[model samples]
Target chain A: MMNPKGTQPEDLVWECQACHVNLVEGPVTLMYMGNRITVDLPQCPRCGFVLVSEAVALGKMAEVEQALEDK
Target chain B: MTAFTARALSHVPHVLRGITGNTLRPGGLALTERAADWCAFQPGARVLDIGCGLGATLMYLRDIRGCRACGLAISAQMLSECRGMPVLQAAGDILPFYDKCLDGIFCECVVSLLVEPPKAFREFCRVLRPAGWLVLTDVYLRNPQSGAGDLAASATCLSGASDNTELMKHLNDCGFDVILWEDHSRYLTELAARMVWTLGSRELLMQLLFPGGCSAENKQNMQGASPGYGLWIARLKGPKR
Candidate 1:
Protein backbone atom coordinates (compact mmCIF):
# COMPACT_ATOMS: atom_id res chain seq x y z
CA MET A 1 0.00 0.00 0.00
CA MET A 2 3.04 2.27 -0.03
CA ASN A 3 3.29 4.77 -2.87
CA PRO A 4 5.81 3.79 -5.52
CA LYS A 5 8.52 6.40 -5.87
CA GLY A 6 7.71 9.29 -8.26
CA THR A 7 3.96 8.68 -8.24
CA GLN A 8 0.89 9.89 -6.35
CA PRO A 9 -2.83 9.32 -6.82
CA GLU A 10 -3.52 12.08 -9.31
CA ASP A 11 -7.30 11.94 -9.00
CA LEU A 12 -9.18 8.89 -7.68
CA VAL A 13 -8.06 5.54 -6.26
CA TRP A 14 -8.27 2.16 -7.97
CA GLU A 15 -10.62 0.76 -5.34
CA CYS A 16 -13.76 -1.31 -5.28
CA GLN A 17 -16.52 0.58 -3.46
CA ALA A 18 -18.31 -2.68 -2.71
CA CYS A 19 -15.88 -4.96 -0.86
CA HIS A 20 -13.35 -2.11 -0.80
CA VAL A 21 -10.83 -4.13 -2.75
CA ASN A 22 -8.03 -2.27 -4.47
CA LEU A 23 -7.24 -3.56 -7.97
CA VAL A 24 -3.84 -1.91 -7.92
CA GLU A 25 -3.12 -1.23 -4.31
CA GLY A 26 -0.05 0.84 -5.08
CA PRO A 27 0.84 4.03 -6.91
CA VAL A 28 0.11 4.33 -10.62
CA THR A 29 1.30 6.73 -13.27
CA LEU A 30 -2.07 6.70 -14.98
CA MET A 31 -5.47 5.27 -14.03
CA TYR A 32 -8.16 4.53 -16.62
CA MET A 33 -11.81 4.78 -15.64
CA GLY A 34 -13.65 3.21 -18.61
CA ASN A 35 -16.79 5.35 -18.40
CA ARG A 36 -17.95 8.04 -16.06
CA ILE A 37 -15.91 8.76 -12.92
CA THR A 38 -15.11 5.12 -12.30
CA VAL A 39 -12.57 3.35 -10.12
CA ASP A 40 -10.77 0.13 -10.97
CA LEU A 41 -11.84 -2.51 -8.47
CA PRO A 42 -10.38 -5.93 -7.79
CA GLN A 43 -12.40 -9.06 -7.01
CA CYS A 44 -12.92 -9.54 -3.32
CA PRO A 45 -10.10 -11.60 -1.87
CA ARG A 46 -12.54 -13.25 0.55
CA CYS A 47 -15.88 -13.24 -1.32
CA GLY A 48 -15.01 -13.87 -4.98
CA PHE A 49 -17.34 -11.09 -6.14
CA VAL A 50 -17.09 -9.64 -9.66
CA LEU A 51 -18.28 -6.46 -11.35
CA VAL A 52 -18.59 -4.83 -7.96
CA SER A 53 -19.46 -1.19 -8.39
CA GLU A 54 -20.46 1.45 -5.86
CA ALA A 55 -24.14 1.37 -6.85
CA VAL A 56 -24.19 -2.41 -6.54
CA ALA A 57 -22.64 -2.26 -3.06
CA LEU A 58 -25.21 0.28 -1.81
CA GLY A 59 -28.03 -1.93 -3.01
CA LYS A 60 -26.42 -5.04 -1.51
CA MET A 61 -25.85 -3.32 1.81
CA ALA A 62 -29.59 -2.67 2.24
CA GLU A 63 -30.40 -6.27 1.40
CA VAL A 64 -27.88 -7.52 3.98
CA GLU A 65 -29.19 -5.22 6.70
CA GLN A 66 -32.82 -6.23 5.97
CA ALA A 67 -31.84 -9.90 6.01
CA LEU A 68 -30.12 -9.51 9.37
CA GLU A 69 -33.27 -7.84 10.82
CA ASP A 70 -35.46 -10.62 9.45
CA LYS A 71 -33.29 -13.17 11.21
CA MET B 1 7.69 -9.84 -45.47
CA THR B 2 9.73 -12.03 -43.10
CA ALA B 3 12.85 -11.02 -44.93
CA PHE B 4 11.85 -7.40 -44.64
CA THR B 5 11.18 -7.78 -40.94
CA ALA B 6 14.55 -9.45 -40.37
CA ARG B 7 16.29 -6.68 -42.26
CA ALA B 8 14.28 -4.05 -40.39
CA LEU B 9 15.32 -5.43 -37.01
CA SER B 10 18.94 -5.56 -38.13
CA HIS B 11 18.81 -1.88 -38.96
CA VAL B 12 17.18 -0.97 -35.62
CA PRO B 13 20.50 -0.79 -33.75
CA HIS B 14 21.93 1.75 -36.16
CA VAL B 15 18.72 3.75 -36.32
CA LEU B 16 18.38 3.70 -32.54
CA ARG B 17 21.99 4.79 -32.03
CA GLY B 18 21.34 7.90 -34.09
CA ILE B 19 18.11 8.78 -32.24
CA THR B 20 19.40 8.35 -28.68
CA GLY B 21 22.61 9.72 -27.28
CA ASN B 22 22.72 6.64 -25.05
CA THR B 23 22.74 4.24 -28.04
CA LEU B 24 19.04 3.25 -27.83
CA ARG B 25 15.80 4.57 -29.22
CA PRO B 26 13.67 7.06 -27.31
CA GLY B 27 10.98 4.45 -26.95
CA GLY B 28 13.40 2.07 -25.24
CA LEU B 29 14.40 4.74 -22.80
CA ALA B 30 10.77 5.56 -22.16
CA LEU B 31 10.07 1.94 -21.29
CA THR B 32 13.03 1.92 -18.92
CA GLU B 33 11.69 4.97 -17.17
CA ARG B 34 8.27 3.37 -17.04
CA ALA B 35 9.68 0.30 -15.27
CA ALA B 36 11.85 2.20 -12.83
CA ASP B 37 9.14 4.70 -12.00
CA TRP B 38 6.56 2.01 -11.41
CA CYS B 39 8.50 -0.80 -9.76
CA ALA B 40 10.45 -0.54 -6.54
CA PHE B 41 13.56 -2.29 -7.70
CA GLN B 42 15.93 -2.98 -4.85
CA PRO B 43 19.60 -2.38 -5.45
CA GLY B 44 21.39 -5.32 -7.07
CA ALA B 45 18.12 -7.00 -7.98
CA ARG B 46 18.40 -9.43 -10.87
CA VAL B 47 16.44 -8.11 -13.88
CA LEU B 48 15.50 -9.81 -17.13
CA ASP B 49 14.52 -7.82 -20.19
CA ILE B 50 12.67 -9.80 -22.86
CA GLY B 51 13.40 -8.60 -26.39
CA CYS B 52 15.97 -6.16 -25.16
CA GLY B 53 16.68 -4.50 -28.50
CA LEU B 54 20.04 -2.72 -28.50
CA GLY B 55 20.07 -3.32 -24.70
CA ALA B 56 19.27 0.33 -24.20
CA THR B 57 16.57 -0.15 -21.58
CA LEU B 58 18.71 -2.56 -19.62
CA MET B 59 21.58 -0.10 -19.68
CA TYR B 60 19.26 2.58 -18.40
CA LEU B 61 18.18 0.39 -15.51
CA ARG B 62 21.77 -0.41 -14.68
CA ASP B 63 22.74 3.22 -14.78
CA ILE B 64 19.72 4.64 -12.98
CA ARG B 65 18.78 1.97 -10.47
CA GLY B 66 22.05 0.08 -10.07
CA CYS B 67 20.20 -3.18 -10.73
CA ARG B 68 21.97 -6.17 -12.21
CA ALA B 69 20.24 -6.80 -15.52
CA CYS B 70 20.32 -9.21 -18.46
CA GLY B 71 18.70 -9.00 -21.91
CA LEU B 72 17.28 -11.56 -24.35
CA ALA B 73 16.59 -10.95 -28.04
CA ILE B 74 15.49 -13.24 -30.88
CA SER B 75 17.76 -11.76 -33.53
CA ALA B 76 21.21 -13.29 -33.47
CA GLN B 77 22.44 -10.39 -35.55
CA MET B 78 21.11 -8.01 -32.91
CA LEU B 79 22.49 -10.17 -30.13
CA SER B 80 25.89 -10.26 -31.80
CA GLU B 81 25.82 -6.49 -31.73
CA CYS B 82 25.35 -6.72 -27.94
CA ARG B 83 28.66 -8.51 -27.40
CA GLY B 84 30.56 -7.59 -24.22
CA MET B 85 27.23 -6.49 -22.75
CA PRO B 86 24.94 -8.43 -20.44
CA VAL B 87 22.61 -9.85 -23.07
CA LEU B 88 21.83 -13.17 -24.76
CA GLN B 89 19.98 -14.22 -27.90
CA ALA B 90 16.88 -16.07 -26.70
CA ALA B 91 13.20 -16.51 -27.35
CA GLY B 92 10.56 -14.93 -25.12
CA ASP B 93 8.43 -18.08 -24.99
CA ILE B 94 11.28 -20.34 -23.86
CA LEU B 95 13.51 -18.30 -21.67
CA PRO B 96 16.86 -19.71 -20.53
CA PHE B 97 16.37 -19.40 -16.80
CA TYR B 98 15.35 -21.38 -13.74
CA ASP B 99 11.99 -20.96 -12.05
CA LYS B 100 11.39 -18.13 -9.61
CA CYS B 101 14.90 -16.76 -9.96
CA LEU B 102 14.53 -13.20 -11.14
CA ASP B 103 13.42 -10.09 -9.30
CA GLY B 104 11.82 -8.42 -12.31
CA ILE B 105 10.86 -9.00 -15.94
CA PHE B 106 10.92 -6.17 -18.43
CA CYS B 107 9.20 -6.67 -21.79
CA GLU B 108 8.87 -3.66 -24.00
CA CYS B 109 6.90 -3.91 -27.22
CA VAL B 110 7.61 -7.60 -27.55
CA VAL B 111 4.61 -9.75 -26.59
CA SER B 112 2.06 -8.33 -29.05
CA LEU B 113 3.90 -9.85 -32.01
CA LEU B 114 4.19 -13.36 -30.58
CA VAL B 115 2.31 -16.31 -32.10
CA GLU B 116 1.48 -17.36 -28.55
CA PRO B 117 1.56 -14.56 -26.03
CA PRO B 118 0.34 -16.87 -23.27
CA LYS B 119 3.46 -18.94 -23.61
CA ALA B 120 5.62 -15.87 -23.33
CA PHE B 121 3.60 -14.69 -20.34
CA ARG B 122 4.00 -18.04 -18.62
CA GLU B 123 7.71 -18.00 -19.22
CA PHE B 124 7.97 -14.57 -17.63
CA CYS B 125 6.01 -15.81 -14.64
CA ARG B 126 8.19 -18.85 -14.40
CA VAL B 127 11.39 -16.83 -14.15
CA LEU B 128 10.16 -14.18 -11.76
CA ARG B 129 10.43 -14.50 -7.98
CA PRO B 130 7.42 -14.00 -5.76
CA ALA B 131 5.82 -10.60 -6.22
CA GLY B 132 8.30 -9.80 -8.97
CA TRP B 133 7.27 -6.95 -11.22
CA LEU B 134 6.49 -7.34 -14.94
CA VAL B 135 6.76 -4.06 -16.79
CA LEU B 136 5.76 -3.87 -20.46
CA THR B 137 5.27 -1.06 -22.91
CA ASP B 138 3.96 -2.04 -26.34
CA VAL B 139 1.51 -1.39 -29.15
CA TYR B 140 -2.06 -2.62 -28.67
CA LEU B 141 -5.36 -2.22 -30.53
CA ARG B 142 -7.25 0.88 -29.56
CA ASN B 143 -10.38 0.48 -31.64
CA PRO B 144 -12.10 -2.83 -30.98
CA GLN B 145 -13.96 -2.24 -34.24
CA SER B 146 -10.85 -3.09 -36.27
CA GLY B 147 -11.30 -6.84 -36.34
CA ALA B 148 -9.34 -9.74 -37.86
CA GLY B 149 -8.47 -8.07 -41.15
CA ASP B 150 -6.88 -5.14 -39.41
CA LEU B 151 -4.97 -7.46 -37.12
CA ALA B 152 -3.87 -9.69 -39.98
CA ALA B 153 -2.75 -6.71 -42.03
CA SER B 154 -0.59 -5.37 -39.22
CA ALA B 155 0.40 -8.70 -37.72
CA THR B 156 4.15 -9.19 -37.61
CA CYS B 157 6.66 -11.09 -35.52
CA LEU B 158 7.07 -7.65 -34.04
CA SER B 159 3.48 -6.37 -33.66
CA GLY B 160 0.00 -7.87 -33.75
CA ALA B 161 -2.05 -6.02 -31.15
CA SER B 162 -5.55 -7.30 -31.87
CA ASP B 163 -7.51 -5.60 -29.09
CA ASN B 164 -7.15 -4.33 -25.53
CA THR B 165 -9.53 -6.77 -23.85
CA GLU B 166 -7.93 -9.75 -25.52
CA LEU B 167 -4.51 -8.48 -24.55
CA MET B 168 -5.60 -8.14 -20.91
CA LYS B 169 -7.21 -11.56 -20.94
CA HIS B 170 -4.01 -13.18 -22.18
CA LEU B 171 -2.01 -11.53 -19.41
CA ASN B 172 -4.49 -12.58 -16.77
CA ASP B 173 -4.58 -16.10 -18.11
CA CYS B 174 -0.79 -16.22 -18.04
CA GLY B 175 -1.00 -15.58 -14.31
CA PHE B 176 0.07 -11.97 -14.30
CA ASP B 177 -1.74 -9.49 -12.12
CA VAL B 178 -2.51 -6.57 -14.40
CA ILE B 179 -1.19 -3.49 -12.71
CA LEU B 180 -1.53 -0.98 -15.50
CA TRP B 181 -2.57 -0.76 -19.15
CA GLU B 182 -3.03 2.29 -21.35
CA ASP B 183 -3.87 3.21 -24.91
CA HIS B 184 -1.09 5.31 -26.36
CA SER B 185 -2.96 5.71 -29.61
CA ARG B 186 -2.28 9.39 -30.15
CA TYR B 187 1.44 8.99 -29.55
CA LEU B 188 1.76 6.08 -31.99
CA THR B 189 -0.35 7.89 -34.59
CA GLU B 190 2.00 10.84 -34.37
CA LEU B 191 5.01 8.52 -34.46
CA ALA B 192 3.66 6.76 -37.54
CA ALA B 193 3.18 10.10 -39.26
CA ARG B 194 6.76 10.98 -38.45
CA MET B 195 8.04 7.63 -39.80
CA VAL B 196 5.98 7.99 -42.97
CA TRP B 197 7.10 11.53 -43.48
CA THR B 198 10.72 10.65 -42.82
CA LEU B 199 10.69 7.75 -45.28
CA GLY B 200 8.22 9.07 -47.87
CA SER B 201 9.95 12.38 -48.44
CA ARG B 202 13.08 10.53 -49.53
CA GLU B 203 11.83 8.53 -52.52
CA LEU B 204 14.97 6.55 -53.33
CA LEU B 205 15.80 5.93 -49.68
CA MET B 206 12.21 4.99 -48.91
CA GLN B 207 12.28 2.36 -51.65
CA LEU B 208 15.59 1.12 -50.34
CA LEU B 209 14.24 0.80 -46.79
CA PHE B 210 10.78 -0.57 -47.46
CA PRO B 211 11.49 -2.31 -50.81
CA GLY B 212 8.12 -3.73 -51.92
CA GLY B 213 5.84 -1.20 -50.30
CA CYS B 214 3.74 1.16 -52.41
CA SER B 215 5.07 4.43 -53.73
CA ALA B 216 6.54 6.68 -51.05
CA GLU B 217 3.48 8.93 -50.98
CA ASN B 218 1.09 6.00 -50.84
CA LYS B 219 3.03 4.30 -48.06
CA GLN B 220 2.99 7.50 -46.09
CA ASN B 221 -0.77 7.81 -46.50
CA MET B 222 -1.31 4.21 -45.43
CA GLN B 223 0.84 4.42 -42.31
CA GLY B 224 -0.84 7.70 -41.41
CA ALA B 225 -4.30 6.12 -41.27
CA SER B 226 -3.57 3.22 -38.89
CA PRO B 227 -4.85 3.06 -35.34
CA GLY B 228 -2.38 3.91 -32.55
CA TYR B 229 -0.29 2.10 -29.90
CA GLY B 230 -0.70 0.96 -26.31
CA LEU B 231 1.27 0.17 -23.11
CA TRP B 232 0.86 -2.25 -20.21
CA ILE B 233 2.56 -3.04 -16.88
CA ALA B 234 1.76 -6.12 -14.87
CA ARG B 235 3.13 -8.18 -11.97
CA LEU B 236 4.12 -11.81 -12.33
CA LYS B 237 2.10 -13.94 -9.91
CA GLY B 238 3.91 -16.48 -7.80
CA PRO B 239 3.90 -20.06 -9.03
CA LYS B 240 1.08 -22.33 -7.88
CA ARG B 241 3.44 -24.56 -5.94
Candidate 2:
Protein backbone atom coordinates (compact mmCIF):
# COMPACT_ATOMS: atom_id res chain seq x y z
CA MET A 1 0.00 0.00 0.00
CA MET A 2 1.06 3.58 -0.65
CA ASN A 3 1.82 5.97 2.21
CA PRO A 4 -0.65 8.59 3.35
CA LYS A 5 0.94 11.07 0.95
CA GLY A 6 0.44 8.69 -2.01
CA THR A 7 4.10 7.85 -2.24
CA GLN A 8 5.25 4.34 -3.04
CA PRO A 9 5.31 1.89 -0.12
CA GLU A 10 9.11 1.77 -0.22
CA ASP A 11 9.40 5.50 0.50
CA LEU A 12 7.95 5.35 3.98
CA VAL A 13 9.60 4.04 7.16
CA TRP A 14 7.92 3.11 10.43
CA GLU A 15 9.59 2.67 13.83
CA CYS A 16 8.37 2.88 17.39
CA GLN A 17 9.62 5.91 19.25
CA ALA A 18 9.88 4.38 22.71
CA CYS A 19 11.21 0.90 21.94
CA HIS A 20 13.15 1.92 18.83
CA VAL A 21 11.90 -1.21 17.09
CA ASN A 22 10.45 -1.54 13.63
CA LEU A 23 6.72 -0.97 13.85
CA VAL A 24 4.19 -2.95 11.87
CA GLU A 25 0.96 -1.34 10.80
CA GLY A 26 -2.01 -2.59 12.82
CA PRO A 27 -5.35 -1.55 14.28
CA VAL A 28 -5.47 0.74 17.31
CA THR A 29 -8.42 2.15 19.20
CA LEU A 30 -8.41 5.86 19.88
CA MET A 31 -10.57 7.78 22.34
CA TYR A 32 -11.65 11.30 21.44
CA MET A 33 -14.43 13.27 23.11
CA GLY A 34 -15.66 10.05 24.82
CA ASN A 35 -16.01 8.17 21.52
CA ARG A 36 -13.89 5.28 20.33
CA ILE A 37 -12.45 5.05 16.84
CA THR A 38 -10.35 2.18 15.56
CA VAL A 39 -7.80 2.90 12.83
CA ASP A 40 -4.73 1.19 11.49
CA LEU A 41 -1.30 2.69 12.21
CA PRO A 42 2.27 1.74 12.72
CA GLN A 43 2.91 -0.09 15.97
CA CYS A 44 5.67 -1.59 18.06
CA PRO A 45 5.59 -5.35 17.54
CA ARG A 46 7.18 -6.26 20.86
CA CYS A 47 5.49 -3.77 23.18
CA GLY A 48 2.11 -3.42 21.46
CA PHE A 49 2.62 0.32 21.27
CA VAL A 50 0.82 2.10 18.46
CA LEU A 51 2.08 5.23 16.81
CA VAL A 52 -0.25 7.99 15.71
CA SER A 53 1.52 10.40 13.49
CA GLU A 54 0.81 14.11 13.67
CA ALA A 55 -0.94 14.11 10.33
CA VAL A 56 -3.43 11.42 11.37
CA ALA A 57 -3.97 12.81 14.84
CA LEU A 58 -4.69 16.34 13.69
CA GLY A 59 -6.22 15.31 10.41
CA LYS A 60 -8.42 12.17 10.32
CA MET A 61 -8.89 11.59 14.04
CA ALA A 62 -9.69 15.22 14.69
CA GLU A 63 -12.16 15.25 11.82
CA VAL A 64 -13.85 12.07 13.08
CA GLU A 65 -14.37 13.61 16.48
CA GLN A 66 -15.87 16.68 14.91
CA ALA A 67 -18.33 14.64 12.85
CA LEU A 68 -19.38 12.58 15.85
CA GLU A 69 -19.87 15.73 17.85
CA ASP A 70 -21.93 17.16 15.02
CA LYS A 71 -24.24 14.18 15.27
CA MET B 1 -41.86 4.89 -24.95
CA THR B 2 -40.99 8.54 -25.49
CA ALA B 3 -42.70 9.57 -22.27
CA PHE B 4 -40.89 6.85 -20.31
CA THR B 5 -37.59 7.90 -21.80
CA ALA B 6 -38.28 11.55 -21.00
CA ARG B 7 -39.19 10.74 -17.43
CA ALA B 8 -35.97 8.77 -17.09
CA LEU B 9 -34.06 11.69 -18.55
CA SER B 10 -35.66 14.02 -16.02
CA HIS B 11 -34.45 11.74 -13.20
CA VAL B 12 -30.89 11.98 -14.50
CA PRO B 13 -30.56 15.61 -13.39
CA HIS B 14 -31.40 14.61 -9.81
CA VAL B 15 -28.50 12.19 -9.64
CA LEU B 16 -25.03 13.35 -8.61
CA ARG B 17 -23.89 12.46 -12.10
CA GLY B 18 -25.39 15.75 -13.24
CA ILE B 19 -22.76 17.59 -11.23
CA THR B 20 -19.96 15.05 -11.53
CA GLY B 21 -19.88 12.41 -14.28
CA ASN B 22 -21.82 9.34 -15.35
CA THR B 23 -22.09 6.45 -12.86
CA LEU B 24 -22.56 8.76 -9.81
CA ARG B 25 -20.29 6.55 -7.72
CA PRO B 26 -16.58 7.21 -7.51
CA GLY B 27 -14.14 5.28 -9.73
CA GLY B 28 -17.10 4.84 -12.11
CA LEU B 29 -17.36 1.74 -14.28
CA ALA B 30 -13.66 0.97 -13.93
CA LEU B 31 -14.11 0.31 -10.23
CA THR B 32 -17.24 -1.68 -10.97
CA GLU B 33 -15.26 -3.87 -13.32
CA ARG B 34 -12.54 -4.22 -10.69
CA ALA B 35 -15.10 -5.30 -8.09
CA ALA B 36 -16.66 -7.74 -10.55
CA ASP B 37 -13.27 -9.18 -11.38
CA TRP B 38 -12.51 -9.57 -7.72
CA CYS B 39 -15.80 -11.42 -7.13
CA ALA B 40 -14.93 -13.73 -10.06
CA PHE B 41 -18.59 -14.63 -10.42
CA GLN B 42 -19.41 -17.79 -12.33
CA PRO B 43 -21.77 -18.01 -15.26
CA GLY B 44 -25.48 -17.88 -14.34
CA ALA B 45 -24.68 -16.66 -10.84
CA ARG B 46 -27.68 -14.80 -9.54
CA VAL B 47 -26.46 -11.32 -8.59
CA LEU B 48 -28.41 -8.35 -7.28
CA ASP B 49 -27.14 -4.80 -7.59
CA ILE B 50 -28.40 -2.84 -4.63
CA GLY B 51 -28.89 0.87 -5.37
CA CYS B 52 -28.17 0.04 -8.95
CA GLY B 53 -28.44 3.64 -10.19
CA LEU B 54 -28.86 3.93 -13.99
CA GLY B 55 -28.64 0.09 -14.21
CA ALA B 56 -25.28 0.32 -15.94
CA THR B 57 -23.52 -2.15 -13.67
CA LEU B 58 -26.39 -4.61 -13.91
CA MET B 59 -26.27 -4.46 -17.69
CA TYR B 60 -22.51 -4.94 -17.64
CA LEU B 61 -22.82 -8.01 -15.45
CA ARG B 62 -25.58 -9.48 -17.59
CA ASP B 63 -24.10 -8.84 -21.00
CA ILE B 64 -20.40 -9.33 -20.20
CA ARG B 65 -20.32 -11.99 -17.51
CA GLY B 66 -23.51 -13.84 -18.45
CA CYS B 67 -24.78 -13.47 -14.87
CA ARG B 68 -28.44 -13.39 -14.02
CA ALA B 69 -28.33 -9.86 -12.67
CA CYS B 70 -31.25 -7.95 -11.19
CA GLY B 71 -31.34 -4.40 -9.92
CA LEU B 72 -32.97 -2.62 -6.98
CA ALA B 73 -33.29 1.13 -6.65
CA ILE B 74 -35.24 3.24 -4.22
CA SER B 75 -36.34 5.81 -6.76
CA ALA B 76 -39.12 4.84 -9.14
CA GLN B 77 -37.89 7.56 -11.46
CA MET B 78 -34.45 5.92 -11.50
CA LEU B 79 -36.06 2.54 -12.15
CA SER B 80 -37.77 3.93 -15.25
CA GLU B 81 -34.48 4.00 -17.12
CA CYS B 82 -33.91 0.36 -16.23
CA ARG B 83 -36.95 -1.01 -18.08
CA GLY B 84 -34.88 -3.51 -20.04
CA MET B 85 -33.40 -4.88 -16.80
CA PRO B 86 -35.30 -6.73 -14.10
CA VAL B 87 -35.52 -4.26 -11.24
CA LEU B 88 -37.59 -3.58 -8.15
CA GLN B 89 -38.20 -0.41 -6.24
CA ALA B 90 -37.13 -1.13 -2.67
CA ALA B 91 -34.80 -0.17 0.13
CA GLY B 92 -31.72 -2.18 1.03
CA ASP B 93 -32.73 -2.85 4.65
CA ILE B 94 -35.80 -4.80 3.56
CA LEU B 95 -34.89 -6.94 0.57
CA PRO B 96 -37.79 -8.75 -1.14
CA PHE B 97 -35.93 -12.01 -1.67
CA TYR B 98 -36.13 -15.38 0.03
CA ASP B 99 -33.31 -16.55 2.24
CA LYS B 100 -30.27 -18.01 0.55
CA CYS B 101 -31.53 -17.10 -2.90
CA LEU B 102 -28.83 -14.89 -4.31
CA ASP B 103 -25.35 -16.01 -5.27
CA GLY B 104 -23.83 -12.54 -5.12
CA ILE B 105 -24.63 -8.86 -4.41
CA PHE B 106 -23.09 -5.70 -5.83
CA CYS B 107 -23.64 -2.65 -3.68
CA GLU B 108 -21.62 0.39 -4.69
CA CYS B 109 -21.48 3.62 -2.71
CA VAL B 110 -24.93 3.01 -1.31
CA VAL B 111 -24.26 1.82 2.24
CA SER B 112 -23.12 5.22 3.45
CA LEU B 113 -26.44 6.73 2.46
CA LEU B 114 -28.39 4.11 4.38
CA VAL B 115 -30.20 5.31 7.48
CA GLU B 116 -29.81 1.87 9.05
CA PRO B 117 -26.66 0.26 7.76
CA PRO B 118 -26.63 -2.51 10.33
CA LYS B 119 -30.13 -3.55 9.37
CA ALA B 120 -29.18 -3.50 5.71
CA PHE B 121 -26.12 -5.63 6.40
CA ARG B 122 -28.31 -8.15 8.19
CA GLU B 123 -30.66 -8.15 5.24
CA PHE B 124 -27.74 -8.78 2.89
CA CYS B 125 -26.71 -11.73 5.04
CA ARG B 126 -30.24 -13.10 5.03
CA VAL B 127 -30.67 -13.04 1.25
CA LEU B 128 -27.37 -14.59 0.17
CA ARG B 129 -26.73 -18.31 0.05
CA PRO B 130 -23.86 -19.87 1.95
CA ALA B 131 -20.57 -18.69 0.52
CA GLY B 132 -22.35 -16.02 -1.52
CA TRP B 133 -20.12 -13.08 -2.37
CA LEU B 134 -20.80 -9.41 -1.65
CA VAL B 135 -18.94 -6.66 -3.47
CA LEU B 136 -19.29 -3.38 -1.61
CA THR B 137 -17.74 0.00 -2.24
CA ASP B 138 -18.41 3.23 -0.34
CA VAL B 139 -16.91 6.30 1.27
CA TYR B 140 -15.66 6.07 4.87
CA LEU B 141 -14.64 8.58 7.49
CA ARG B 142 -10.95 8.68 8.10
CA ASN B 143 -11.63 11.66 10.30
CA PRO B 144 -15.03 12.08 11.92
CA GLN B 145 -14.55 15.54 13.36
CA SER B 146 -14.52 17.07 9.92
CA GLY B 147 -18.25 16.49 9.62
CA ALA B 148 -19.22 18.20 12.85
CA GLY B 149 -22.09 20.71 13.27
CA ASP B 150 -23.77 19.76 10.03
CA LEU B 151 -26.61 17.27 9.65
CA ALA B 152 -26.81 17.96 5.93
CA ALA B 153 -23.44 16.29 5.39
CA SER B 154 -24.93 12.99 6.54
CA ALA B 155 -27.46 13.30 3.75
CA THR B 156 -24.49 13.49 1.39
CA CYS B 157 -23.09 10.18 2.75
CA LEU B 158 -20.12 11.85 4.45
CA SER B 159 -21.34 11.70 8.06
CA GLY B 160 -22.73 8.18 7.79
CA ALA B 161 -19.38 6.74 6.69
CA SER B 162 -17.79 4.29 9.11
CA ASP B 163 -14.13 3.96 9.84
CA ASN B 164 -12.44 0.70 8.89
CA THR B 165 -12.83 -0.82 12.34
CA GLU B 166 -16.51 -0.05 12.61
CA LEU B 167 -17.04 -1.36 9.10
CA MET B 168 -15.27 -4.65 9.93
CA LYS B 169 -17.39 -5.09 13.06
CA HIS B 170 -20.57 -4.49 11.10
CA LEU B 171 -19.62 -7.05 8.44
CA ASN B 172 -18.51 -9.60 11.04
CA ASP B 173 -21.64 -9.05 13.08
CA CYS B 174 -23.67 -9.78 9.97
CA GLY B 175 -21.90 -13.15 9.49
CA PHE B 176 -19.66 -12.05 6.65
CA ASP B 177 -16.04 -13.02 6.22
CA VAL B 178 -14.07 -10.33 4.46
CA ILE B 179 -11.96 -11.79 1.71
CA LEU B 180 -10.44 -8.49 0.56
CA TRP B 181 -10.39 -4.87 1.65
CA GLU B 182 -8.79 -2.27 -0.59
CA ASP B 183 -8.37 1.45 0.01
CA HIS B 184 -9.40 3.38 -3.08
CA SER B 185 -9.19 6.86 -1.62
CA ARG B 186 -7.27 8.07 -4.66
CA TYR B 187 -10.32 7.45 -6.82
CA LEU B 188 -12.47 9.50 -4.44
CA THR B 189 -9.95 12.33 -4.52
CA GLU B 190 -9.91 12.22 -8.28
CA LEU B 191 -13.70 12.30 -8.38
CA ALA B 192 -13.75 15.25 -6.01
CA ALA B 193 -11.30 17.04 -8.24
CA ARG B 194 -13.48 16.34 -11.23
CA MET B 195 -16.55 17.58 -9.39
CA VAL B 196 -14.70 20.74 -8.47
CA TRP B 197 -13.75 21.21 -12.09
CA THR B 198 -17.12 20.40 -13.65
CA LEU B 199 -19.19 22.37 -11.14
CA GLY B 200 -16.68 25.26 -11.34
CA SER B 201 -16.79 25.37 -7.54
CA ARG B 202 -17.83 22.92 -4.84
CA GLU B 203 -18.71 25.91 -2.72
CA LEU B 204 -21.23 27.13 -5.27
CA LEU B 205 -22.98 23.76 -5.33
CA MET B 206 -22.89 23.49 -1.53
CA GLN B 207 -24.40 26.92 -1.16
CA LEU B 208 -27.12 26.16 -3.71
CA LEU B 209 -28.04 22.93 -1.93
CA PHE B 210 -27.59 23.75 1.76
CA PRO B 211 -27.80 27.57 1.50
CA GLY B 212 -27.09 28.79 5.05
CA GLY B 213 -26.23 25.30 6.29
CA CYS B 214 -22.87 25.03 4.55
CA SER B 215 -20.46 27.94 4.33
CA ALA B 216 -17.20 28.52 2.52
CA GLU B 217 -15.04 28.34 5.68
CA ASN B 218 -16.83 25.22 6.88
CA LYS B 219 -16.37 23.55 3.52
CA GLN B 220 -12.67 24.28 3.59
CA ASN B 221 -12.39 23.06 7.19
CA MET B 222 -14.18 19.85 6.31
CA GLN B 223 -12.12 19.21 3.21
CA GLY B 224 -9.84 16.40 4.40
CA ALA B 225 -12.41 15.23 6.92
CA SER B 226 -13.77 12.83 4.33
CA PRO B 227 -11.31 10.01 4.87
CA GLY B 228 -11.60 8.02 1.64
CA TYR B 229 -13.43 5.23 -0.13
CA GLY B 230 -13.11 1.49 0.30
CA LEU B 231 -13.93 -1.70 -1.59
CA TRP B 232 -14.78 -4.82 0.37
CA ILE B 233 -15.28 -8.34 -0.94
CA ALA B 234 -16.96 -10.49 1.65
CA ARG B 235 -18.66 -13.89 1.72
CA LEU B 236 -21.72 -15.01 3.67
CA LYS B 237 -21.00 -17.80 6.09
CA GLY B 238 -22.90 -21.08 6.19
CA PRO B 239 -26.56 -21.13 7.11
CA LYS B 240 -27.52 -20.15 10.61
CA ARG B 241 -28.75 -22.74 13.13
The candidate that wins on DockQ is 2
The DockQ of each candidate is 0.01, 0.02
* Candidate 1 A-chain TM-score: 0.27
By lDDT, who's the top model here? 2
- For residues B15-73, could you state the per-residue lDDT of candidate 2 as single tens digits? 35753454777777887888788888877999999988778898889999999999987
RMSD of each: 18.7, 14.0
lDDT of 1 by residue, B139-223 (tens): 6544445332323333232236556788789889988888877665544433332233223223433343344544545443434
Worst 10 residues of 2 chain B by lDDT: B1-10
User: Against the hidden true structure, what lDDT does model 2 obtain?
Assistant: 0.71
How far in Å is the alpha carbon of A67 misplaced in model 2? 20
TM-score of chain A of each: 0.27, 0.69
Candidate 2, residue B82: how far the Cα is off, in Å: 0.9
